[model samples]
Target: MKGIVFLGERRLALVEVNDPTPGDGEVVVEIKASGMCGSDLHPYRALQDLSRPPESRVIGGHEPSGIVAAVGRGVPRHVALVGDRVMVHHYHGCTVCRHCRTGWPQLCEPITRTTYSANAHGAHAPYMKVSADTLVPLHDSLSFEAGAAIACGTGTAWGGLERLQPRGDETIAVFGQGPVGLSATLLASTRGSRVIAIDLDDDRLAMARQFGADETINAREANVAEVLRELTGGQGVEMVVETSGSPQAAAAGLQAIAVWGKVCMVGIGGKVTVDTQAMLDRQITVMTSYTMSTVAQKSCADFVVSRNLDLDRLFTHRWRLDQAEDAYRVFDAQVSGKGAFIF
Candidate 1:
């Protein structure tokens, strides 16, 4: 099998590697489509420290949609077959942990191994192995590419919004126009919440409006808090979904949140200075959500299947496994809205 290996900072090579076999309770998926996430660009930019020894060199992709190629022991035959189309969860937690027992396995007590972009072998190759427990069967109607997007971007958005619990009549502000923020805006609008989408890019703002944002604010143009206040009629937004991972955006999100409002931080950018005093004074509840659990992933898939959301529009470009390096280069440029690799 051929796959892209992350050798070091800004260094990735396409090389031939041995095919991975499924272990007990696991299954091997023939890669069909894999989406490149924003977080995946961190290592390439040297944003994430890579001084430690490499954990796994299988492939550097997490959001994968494929068909089952093989199954390992202890897995039911009906649950997975040789040709079954599926979406894989990139990170599989220790099922024995308290967090896993409560359906928050992303915060597993001991932190189980992950795939591709994380600590585990990923799907940016011809084949990838994943725990059978973490694989979700896609409906016949959903394409492999759409399934790939749902596993990470869409699922993360659903999980973040679930944490915030945005209601129908309340106004919610999403502080980014990336895939996660855009997905959140679409989901929030479907739930009847008025969405204020903020981003530095006017093109992304336009995309946000197409996805159902009631208002769009170019953060680079004006004071974000002031614009948000004006949109909300001076009451401020009821909830703030901070997905830019920018310090300024985080602070603005905090300042623009209504009294006692909930602020969910889903982006994983560098550290930001937050005003603890003002947050405490306003009685604001600050929360952060990580990757989605198996349950949340299934919920997101269900929503896509039932609601018929316009997921196909999210794909701006596609590449093959051999073009993996070019994919990263394009992502680093951030010129295209989004992209994926189809095997």
Candidate 2:
């Protein structure tokens, strides 16, 4: 089997590797499609420190969709079939911990293991293994590309919106035009919130409009906070989804949030400086959201099944496993609109 290995320092290589066999409570999946997430770029760019040395290369992807090939001993046969198409949670929690019991595995107790990017080998290869607890069955109608996205990008948006709890009548400002940002805009609009999308790229802004943004702001040309303020009649937005991950964008989002409003930080940007005094004075609530829970992932999957989300539109480009290097280059340059690797 061939997999993409990250050798650190912005280095990625496609190399042949041994296929994985499932262990107890785990299953081996035949890779179908893997989506490149914005968060994946952090490690690709060396923004996050590697937990291990460079010599111990790790498999590079997490957002994968595949068909169940085999189940390990002691795994329940009813959980999945040999031919079932599914998506993995990408991260599993220690079922014994308080957080896991309460349904937040991403904050697993002890926090030693993570799917794909950490201790476990991720899905950047021909085959990968995952715990049955993290696997979700995909409907026949959903594409592998769509299923791949459910692991992170779409799930993150769903988690963020769940935290913010945007109402039908309230307005939401999504400050970023990347895949995750666009996913938030689309989901917010579907929930009947008026979505305002802010981004520097015209292409992404146009896509945001297509996804249901009531208005789009070209942050490079105009003042984002002022535009949002004017759009909200000076009261500011009822809720702000900060997906730009930019320090300035965070500050602007804080400025554009209505008093007592909620701000959900979903983007992975540089270190930001916030005006704590102003936030306290305005009585605003700021929260951070990460990966979705199994329950939340189920909800998101249901939403996709019910709403028939336009996953095809979100899949702007596709590459084969052999094209992994080129794919990273395009993603690093932010050239491909919404890219994925198809087996």
Candidate 3:
């Protein structure tokens, strides 16, 4: 088998390795779709010290959806079976921990964890091995690519929206038209919120429009806070979801939120300065959401199915495993919609 390995400094290699066999309570999945997330760029572009090689060479992708190919001892039929379609939760932790038992293994209390694509092998190849607990059923109604997106990017958007709780009559300002932010526009619109999609790129903002944004604002041309304030009749939007991770955008979101408005920060980035006095005077409530839990991943899929959402529209590019280099080259530009590897 050949797996993609990031060699740091924006370089990657496809190295040959032996096929995996599941161990006790584990299963091996035949990869059908693996998504390319913005977060992947962190490690991809990180500068490495040549003197100190990485401790381990982990696979490169985290958003995985596939069919069960094999199951090991102690894995029950009720848990998984060969040929079952599934999306991976992507994190493994001690099963006894409260967080793990409740579907948030990433927050395992014991601190014992394995995050696919980071510490353990992931789904960048034809096969991936993982605990049966990480499998979240992918509905037959949704495409494998959709399942892959739900496994991470889309699920993260759902988690952020769950935290934002935008109302039907209110307005939501989503700052970023990337995959996650674009997913939020789609989901929040279905919930009846008037969505104001924000981005520096016109193409992505156009994608957001197709995803159901009520309006689009190119931050490059205008003041985000001013535009949002004018859009809401000087009161500002009712809610904000910041997915760009830009310090300027984060600060602008805080400036553009209505009094008592809730803000959910989803993008991972550098520090941003906040106005403590302004927050206090406006009674603003700000929160942050990481990726979704396993249960929430399932719920996200259910929502997509129930809504009959055109999640497939999110993909602007797709590639075979062998096209890993070309795929990342295009995705690294960061101006396009979602990209994935389809097996």
Decoy 3 TM-score against native: 0.98
Instruction: Name the runs in model 1 displaced over 4 angstroms.
Output: 47-58
Candidate maximizing lDDT: 3
**Please, what are the lDDT tens digits per residue for candidate 2 over residues 1-343?**
8778765566677767678989998899998988898777777777434675543677878897999999998778788779988888888777768877665778888774466556788888879988877788887898899888887888889999999987789989998878788888889999899999988889889999999999999988999899999999999998988876888888889989988999999888656778889889889999999878878887898998899787768878899988877788887775346788888
- For candidate 3, give the lDDT of residue 85: 97
Tens-digit lDDT track for model 3 on 1-343?
9888887788787888789999999999999999999998887888965764333488889999999999999998999999999999999999898998899899999989899998889888899999999999999999999999999999999999888776677899999999999999999999999999999999999999999999999999999999999999999999999998889899999999999999999998747888899999999999999899988999999999999998999999999888988888888888999999888
lDDT of predicted model 2 = 0.83
Between 1 and 3, whose TM-score is larger?
3
Ranking by lDDT: 3, 2, 1
Q: Model 1 shows how many backbone clashes?
A: 3
Which residue runs of candidate 3 sit more than 4 Å off their true CA positions? Answer: 51-56
Candidate scoring better on lDDT of 1 and 2: 2
Q: Which candidate is the best by TM-score?
A: 3
